[model samples]
Target: MSNEVVLRGRIVTGSMDIADGVIAADAGRVTYSGPASEYRGKAGPATDNILLPGLVDLHCHGANGSDFSDGSADGARSAARYLHSRGTTTLLASLVTGSPANLVRNLSVLRTLTAEGLIAGSHLEGPFLAAGQCGAHDPSLLLEPDPALVTELLEAAGPSLASMTLAAELPGASGLVELLAPRGIIPSLGHTAAHTAAAAGFLEHAAAALSAPSNPTGRFRPTVTHLFNAMPALHHRSPGPVSASLSAARAGNAVVELIADGVHLAPETVKLVFDLVGAENIALVTDSMAATGLQDGAYQLGSLAVTVDHGVARVDSTGAIAGGTATLLDVVRTTVAAGVPLQDAVLSATAVPAAVLGLSSQAGDLRAGLPADVVVVGPGLTLAGVLRRGEWVAALAPTA
Candidate 1:
């Protein structure tokens, strides 16, 4: 039986674009990806669809009525499967602030999923956050950077722990960075009330520690979790984490994640970040929750009750904007609509996040020798098909 398959279309990748391209895959790997004329093998019928690398979302909570923070293996699997079918071939299951026991339990469940290759890894976005800036998270559940608890969480997640979001201004945050950097876990800064100097100091310290020669793990870089959200806004006199994060990103010392779903930030804000820091240092993510693919209704993010009205999720008690209701592809579309170049938006949603998870070699680009994970979309960027490891996961008629 022949395992080879070829797709021809207008191919767009992180670095290049081909008007008439052919991608050949066999044995679940891309064998060739280049101009159609350059492909010597059997070529499939050409189409007007656009071929893109399967998106990599670094921050995602859930979809399809399943929240990753629920500590339900079955529910997490449902979310991962639903997201994969929607063109996000890889994603980290993100969890919100919760009690120590609950977080450990959730990490345990998510570890199983990561080990099973259902998700990239676990992203802990709570506990070590700033209470003053805890947007949708329960403020009472937020904690300082406790080394003991951090160690316990790391052990609970094992090697599947990819990132942890913390308030850099916390007293022991630098120590936490040292602990995480040596073990390959990214120390992401978020949910903070840190001023410009404090945030800049932490970012510099983290960058230095992660890139230090003493670190056993390969060079890792810190990331800013959903930059501009759950943090103090930038002001001329009192610039906060937003300014520090943007500065770090523009200097190539860190990557900043942006929701870009139109709910978390304005279109002008999205474009402004792109203009300031470029796409290479930005990651477009979907901080989606349980109501992502469902109708407007009530949902749960950890222990908090959320209501989704007009596709926007918000906390019922505090009325703070909750997680997003968009997929990574939808985020890409929104970013593109925000005046960001399509290639740049796609790169941020794909390669930038893949690098954050240390999966650049395995995923995140359309190139030879990588997994044949690709998304087929129409000229308007509507998803028409999705292929994960060369197997069709979702197929629909291309737009005419």
Candidate 2:
């Protein structure tokens, strides 16, 4: 008896869409993915469902009322499991700005989860952000790029540290990039008050440092963390980090993350980014926190207090956007509703972020020899089922 899973639908293979396609997997590896007519194996019964690779999120904080920054192993596990069931098969557990001791503690906890394969890796969204544009992060916990502290955090995270977000305008920011890039840890620029020139210069420096032969990571291009948020707004004269990031993305030098959860940005802004940078340069991320998948209520993001009302999360005192309360799948639905082509939105949510984490071969697309991590959706793009490593994880009746 052979254990094989086969599905037939309209397949979004990351590169193109096949109107009538078949995907076959056995023992957790995709054996074939292409036109149904070409598949040699017995394909499943045809349906109107859409098949896509599982999503990869580069910046998700938490979900299911569990916070990764809370420094609890159980909380981290619960969050990862919840996200995995929701179609995000690969993700980096993100931590917000916190005391050095707390940050190190959280990293230590997440390192274990990474080793267990619950998450792809970890992303430190900061302790190195610009105070002026800290957004929901506690300003009192923000810090300049100190070498000793960076070294300590790196040592604590070990090989599981995938990326760190820092302000480019801060003194010694370049040095931080130099240190992080060569170690295979991506240096993502975010939460800055820098004008165009400074931001552009830093991007150039980062690209150079990452391209060096000495660098070991597959991430050669830097990423802009949740672009246009926690950074200065773009202006005709001022231009800011947002302008610099857009230029870099257009030039194929950087990947910009977009929180297309409908709350973090306007629908027009999501469409504008796809038009300007193309889906290949965009990574759709869910900068979600503890409130995700739960009802509106008070929650904690790092050390700050947050409240979610009407699906929007904000810091209680400052009213700044805290994070997101949507899953990566929800982001894809929102992006499609914003007028972006379905193929483009799916590519950004899947392949682009997988490439950023150096998991292109392992996760990303519906290609032969890759893990059979797939999502099946019905009409209007509503999710119907999820298969991770060839095992059915979430299966719901298809909607009409």
Candidate 3:
């Protein structure tokens, strides 16, 4: 008996495109992915649908009325199920600013979920952030970067701490980056008011530290977390963090995460970033919270009051735009609709994010020998079916 599953559709891998294609998997790993006419293995039912590699999101707080900061196992699992159903098979559970004790407790919950394969890992977006640019994060909870606190959080999170967002201009920011870079934890720069020189200096130091021969993690590439959101815009004269990040990405030393949800960025801005930096240097993230996949209403985002009205989530107290309500799939669709090429948008949503978290070889693209995480979508990018590990996640199966 052959444990093989084949899906035929208009296929779009992170790097390749096939009009009439067949993707065959054996024992939960893709064995072949290419043109159906060229396939030598047994073929399954075929359909004139669109097939895509499952999306990978680097920064997501929660979805489906479940928040990762809730510190509840059931809530975390519910979020995972909802995201997976939406074709996001790989996601990092993001946490917002909170007390050290509360953050540690939430990390424990995320750790269990990550160990159970419910999520990729935890993303701490964080207590070590600048209050001036905290966005929807709780200003009271924001703290200056401290190497000791980072060490404590990492010890608590164990191997489940995938990444952290810190203000690069803070007092202990460099120390935290140097400490975490070699340990395989991605040190993302965000929630800052750093000038161009300060921000560029941070990246230079981080690049040097991560590339050192003695570093256990090889070639660590730090990311600009939710670029242009919490940080200052790229002014012609001031430049700021956004400019430095763009320079680093263009130099192939960094990758930038963009929340392409229309509410977070203007369509022209999104298109401009794509054109300037190219898709390979960008990862489209949702940066979503519990309000995602829900109707417009009040919600909580890490101890902050959030309200969603007409699909835009915002802080109730300050009216500050909160985390996004869109999913990674929605972000991809929005990016493509905003003039980015379809393939480029898809890669930013898929492969680029996977590469950010060091999961490129395992989950990003539709390549042979990788886990069979695939998605079937309609013309408008609406998900019709999803498969994780070669097994259908939703009720819709391929029809003959």
Tens digit of lDDT per residue, candidate 2, span 214-314?
76668788899999999989998899899999999999999999999998899999999999999999999999898888888889998899999999999
Question: What local lDDT score does residue 333 receive in model 2, on the 0 to 100 scale?
Answer: 93
Worst 10 residues of 1 by lDDT: 391-400
Query: Candidates' lDDT values, in order?
Result: 0.90, 0.91, 0.87
Model 3 stretches astray by more than 4 angstroms: 42-46, 213-219, 395-400
Q: Compared with the true structure, what per-residue lDDT tens digits does model 3 show for residues 151-259?
A: 8888889988888888998898999988888777888889999999888888777777777666553337888898899998788889999999999988878889999
Please give the ranking of all candidate structures by TM-score, highest first, separated by commas: 2, 1, 3
CA displacement after TM-score superposition, residue 157 of candidate 2 (Å): 0.7
Candidate 2 whole-model C-alpha lDDT, 0 to 1: 0.91
- Cα error of candidate 2 at position 11, Å: 0.2
TM-score of each: 0.97, 0.97, 0.96
Candidate 3 residue pairs in clash (backbone atoms < 3 Å): none
Worst 10 residues of 3 by lDDT: 391-400
Report lDDT (Cα) of residue 392, candidate 1: 86
Q: In model 3, what lDDT does residue 394 have?
A: 63
Angstrom error of the Cα, residue 158, model 2: value is 0.7
* lDDT winner: 2
Q: How many residue-pair clashes does candidate 2 contain?
A: 0
